[model samples]
Target: MNKSTTIWGHLSAAPHRSLFLAGSFQALLTILWWSIELAGRAGLVAPPLLSGITPTWVHGFLMVYTFFPFFILGFLFTTFPNWMNGEKIRPNRYMAVCLLMVCGVILFYAGLFAGKLLISAGLLLMLTGWANAIAALFHVLLTAPAGDKRHAWVAGTAFVAGWLGLCAYALWVLTDNTDMLNFSRQAGIWFFMLPILLTVSHRMIPFFSSRVLENYVVIRPFGLLWLMVGCAVAHGILHLLDLQGYAWWADLLLAGCALYLSYVWQFFRSFHVRLLAVLHISFAWLGIAMLSFGLQGMLFWLNGGEHYWLGLAPLHMLVVGYFASMVLGMASRVTLGHGGFPLKLDHLTWLLFIAFQVVIVLRVIPDILPFAASMAPKFYLAAGGVWLSCFLLWVIKYAPIYWRARVDGKAG
Candidate 1:
């Protein structure tokens, strides 16, 4: 494949191709909306683009639901079938879903520029695409010849819950209900995003550890998974009711659980391999997030819940530290492996991964540094630039690989 290679030709050939397209689209959105947000926050832009929801909410919605789900679905669509010993997805089906999602993204942005009708339509299309993708995976689970279906089912359930949350958010847009928005956001976080991440990480990290480290213990017990899910459900419920003052309990429990799981999963031992270290360290951020949430809850409870929780700082920790890092590492591995390249993390990629951590830390400065209030805008913009740079680097490195057939001359 050369410059003449059509995106349609590539997209219709494999699930990863479509997924890479979707991810690249979302990355572009991230750069665009983030710049708009930073400019507005820094008072570099006037007549703020506040419509049905705030700009911050818009950014969150795009990142959490739009940007990440494409990557998640891409990974799951490819791997879940293999896990269940089912057939690979047909190209036509996945291509249609990808097209629908792309259109939805376009319409959603257009709605942001125009009116609510377009926004509602866009969200509906997005939700439809999401539902279709999840349903396809569920079908694989249903039809698989034979395999351990437990983890796949759990992950699928979380995706369904996430769809429900997205539905609620769309409802908020249609009806202008702030409460619905809040509920959707909370549900999406605890029920949808975190559960999927935790469940997948639980299943994969230990398995990866066992493979990478000789005699490594695979520590995923059903009980532990259940406990983690239970804690997440409780956290979501507390958030839904706006009773985050009591969230410290759930947060602390989850933190403890995360710590124990990390220990049993041999996080420290995985450091010998940089790629595995990336996964292990990314999971470590789950612990950090829970601990931060617990602390924030305690502070808020002591101060009577008067907006003293550092403004979604803990959530950002999980988003950037865990989700983004894992995505980066996993994407790197998948791209290289599938593209007929060695699954090795070269020095430059490792340095970029470290830079990603720096980006995450920079993003948190405004939340943690009260004295740095005057410099918060600079920090925010700088973080966005850094974040954009990371994705841009990924795109530059992998876009060609994604566009071409596998170097081994394989079909898919």
Candidate 2:
């Protein structure tokens, strides 16, 4: 281990701590959003904090644009330096950009709640933040050195597209227009889900699994690029045509891909510990969510046999299971790496991982069972509580490391 004085000095100098603090603040916001929703359902509040906005839209926006971006920022900041051949990106500029983004999200949400001109102001802030982030990402791609720049390029492109789509979405929401909203949502989904997740899984999943099982072969799907492009086109067309039933087919294809990937993953490796296990577990949910979407589509084709709630199941699964799990896992990994700690996670970390999984079960499983809908709010509350607790645990366990910096004199 490095000397304590050296570590402390490095930690004080590093920007990783600042980024982590921003991320933690975003996590707290997420928990607060969920808690407020729960309170509304429980009749503790007269009017729901999120009354006017559609719950699906609200949740999607928060998960995709709000909470996820902070992690993305942290990841980019921490990883880009190494990718850039050990040159550190300017920290002060990055911090300023982050502050703008965080403040933008706050204003956007406040406007969403207030239903006033603040929405436009929030959108402006968001656009400014996005421009800064994109510029930073571009700088990394052009200047930073990486063995596999393809993944970074893909992620960057997707992020840009997602941000643009979000701008369109804001306009639509502000104007009470559905056409723009539909277009923006589809574009955003393609950018947020397809390229980003695909790149992430490609980069991390196989490597993570290989740690548990020796000599594991990661199977890459043939023509995956073509398939992804096709899906994006199909999704856009379906939205344009207002062909609701076609979503099932789209989902089915996606699910099939995920299932094939999962099989390949499992064949290659099995992890005994929660840290590694969580990655696979989260990917499993991605597959399951797709399957649920397909199932919902099939039921819709049966002519009014399916309940509206059927669709909500897959949405929740994607949001709570796949996205949340991945974020938590990535955040945990980053926290350890940036802090100059060993990669091995402790029991508390494992418990937190398990709690995240439990939140998925509690949130999604009940939607399928009608009788369970009555109990859904209770489960949601419980799950949200667990999620909040986990974040709190994260803050308690990791804050010092984030604040103090790496133990080694090396930069994150």
The number of the candidate with the highest TM-score is 1
| Per-residue accuracy of model 2 over 106-183 as CA lDDT, tens digit each | 776787678646766776777787778778777877876546576677777878887877887788777878887776
Worst 10 residues of 1 by lDDT: 1-10
TM-score of each: 0.94, 0.86
* C-alpha lDDT (0 to 100) for residue 36 of candidate 2: 79
lDDT, candidate 2, at 382? 82
lDDT, each prediction: 0.82, 0.71
Report the C-alpha lDDT of model 1 over 203-276, residue by residue, as the tens digit: 88887777778987677888878888888889989877767789898888889999888888887788788878
Model 2 Cα shift for residue 176 (angstroms): 2.1
Using lDDT as the measure, the top candidate is 1
After superposing all C-alphas onto the true structure, candidate 2 shows an RMSD in angstroms of 4.0
In terms of lDDT, model 1 sits at 0.82
